[model samples]
Target: MDMHILQALKSETRTGNFVGIATANLSSRSELIAQLCEIAGTGRLQPGLRILTDYVGASHYLLARADLLQEAGLDFVVSSDWPFDLVTNLAEAFVGGFGRATELEKCMQLFQPHFAVLPETADVPDGASRQYCSLMFNIGRSRLALMFLFDDGFILSQERLRDVGLLTAYYTSLLQYSGTTTDRDFELTDRELECLFWIAEGKTSDEIAMILGISRNTINNYITSVMRKTATKTRSEAIAFAVRNNLV
Candidate 1:
């Protein structure tokens, strides 16, 4: 639901409240939580994600930072078991579609799963569905998406999909609590971080200039300074660096 509840769930996960909750509310799904706990205990994110993918009968999974999707690169992708060529071909379109949604729309759709069809030109794995599903959730300030590609003719259960979505949030909470997720301190100034944030949201220098009420040239200067300080050769790279380090 809201960030507060998600944060509390994460805290509960860290403090070993899972068993109690599972017994009280997840009687039928206690096995799922137990499996998640085992995976979380191992401190391996890929296995946890893979387990969720299988739980929903999905053929593949792609976990990404939804906020960074607007940036023009795969840097937003946190982990994926999808085919590389397919990912490369669909990445821009997926990110662009996400960027087009309004903030209110995004907020209303959090943890709600939706599906889209793959283009005819795209190469999909044999026996896989042309349609794919995606669910979004937040961990603190970061918004993450979990995408799934299932087999052809297979009907994904709505109830199971919701369970997978909530379980994913729990799995990530454990990872964050166990220090498996990345955390870095950077030297960028507040202005620089602000510039980087807009850029990652797919803003141009001119657009950011208008939004921040500064000259376009000043915005460009801020971005250039960010690139230099971050040792990134381009604006996209700088934004990618910021996203990977969770600076934005």
Candidate 2:
């Protein structure tokens, strides 16, 4: 199934108003990695690709395999309690379709990433000056995140980013049909989901209690349950998770 997806991707990555290929020239997944290498002028390819379940801080991923990026401490992202303040507070428009990060200087402030541990093959330039592009696809109740890395020399045009995002969404649906999706969501009760939905809409516990015809204490309890199940540290974090995962 992955091969078939890759084969389809070969023809899907071309970016143009109908003319040229992007800098990545991403004919295949390997080519995508090679493009990163080419952009960095590294002459060697050690790339990382993590297709996440959400564009935000995600605990679970659909697929994770990146030997190249693990050098920079990216491998620890899922287990770490690192805060993604920007992703949690992203505009609704960004999450609804496709979006790219790091191209616009102002938006870089949203995501927090520690420096990459430089690989043994030091072909690329300084890690501090590297360019990272994360492509996100919002599919129904599911979201897909693809993270790309290269040096500052790479010119990431918006058109190329959009093409990558669209092609990635294509593979996301294929993965779904092939049953590559696993550990989708922690089991949240109906009451917990209801509470999360209301909370996302700016409802307080007392308001949710009145709306659900339940006691405020019960409303709080349900929220607590949601927090516990989602492994979120705070109510705000839990709500962010709900919104990112389309649970609300």
Candidate 3:
């Protein structure tokens, strides 16, 4: 939220896509942790997982905690509308294989800065499968993979995928930040969180006020309060902080 960064985002916001990358890069670890806390604090993993789906534009997404996989297989799909049988049949093997294999680990270390495209092959169910998936590896106890399904021929830039990976790390941190935002006692009023959400979407205070049927000053106050609670400085910093932390 430095004044210089705020000015930069303001200037870039006018340019659209470039600004998203800039803004996303400027997000802070603390704010990202705060959002993760909010997600983890939900108690239910599904909602937090859904945030990843939305953030990455995936039709289906899953986060199977490595150690929790049952003797039979992965306990839950984590997040998705992916076919049930598809998940049930292949979930355990993939988790187990991913567990035994060191490739997943080495991939995390070496291939991290690069995005991975997983082929729809034997492991993934044919009926529920797509032509391509972009995976960002996340390690937590066991191997955790963040998979993004895209239509055929969809291409993502390396730098953009790196951004996705960084954001995914924050997404994983929500589970890691279990004590804070995840605490049942840790709460930000609905209105306050809502304001933060929209601001992250790049809405102006006036736009948010109009959307919420509140005055501009009230809208600004809500944002200011969010910054105070989240310990962020400027609005750009606040939003960047939110993005990095997966707050929105």
Top of the candidates by TM-score: 1
Q: What is the lDDT of residue 40 in candidate 3?
A: 68
Order of the predicted models by TM-score, top scorer first: 1, 3, 2
lDDT of 3 by residue, 1-248 (tens): 10111111211111112112222222233543455567665655566655544443334565543323344534323455555665665565555555574754646542253233333433443222243344545543233455554323323334434455566655556565553454421456789878987775557899999899989999988888888877778775665455434455
Candidate 3: the clashing residue pairs are 27-240, 32-245, 36-174, 37-181, 37-182, 38-181, 41-182
Candidate 2 structure quality by residue, lDDT tens digits, 1-248: 10111112223322221122233333444454454444333211111222221112122122211111112222212121112432232212223222233334323422222122222333322322222344444444343345543333322334444545564455444433433222546487677888887775557899999999999999988988888888887666775565445454
Question: TM-scores of all models?
Answer: 0.73, 0.38, 0.42
Candidate 2 runs further than 4 Å off:
1-137, 141-149, 157-159, 170-187, 198-203, 206-215, 227-233, 236-248
Write down the lDDT of every candidate, Cα atoms only: 0.74, 0.41, 0.50
lDDT of 1: 0.74
Quality of model 2 by C-alpha lDDT: 0.41
Q: 1-248 in candidate 1: lDDT tens per residue?
A: 10111211211211112112121222235667778877777878899887777666566899988877644568788889888888887787787788789999999888887778777778987756678889999977678899887656554466667888998997887666555333234467788889888897778898999999999999999899889887899876887787656666
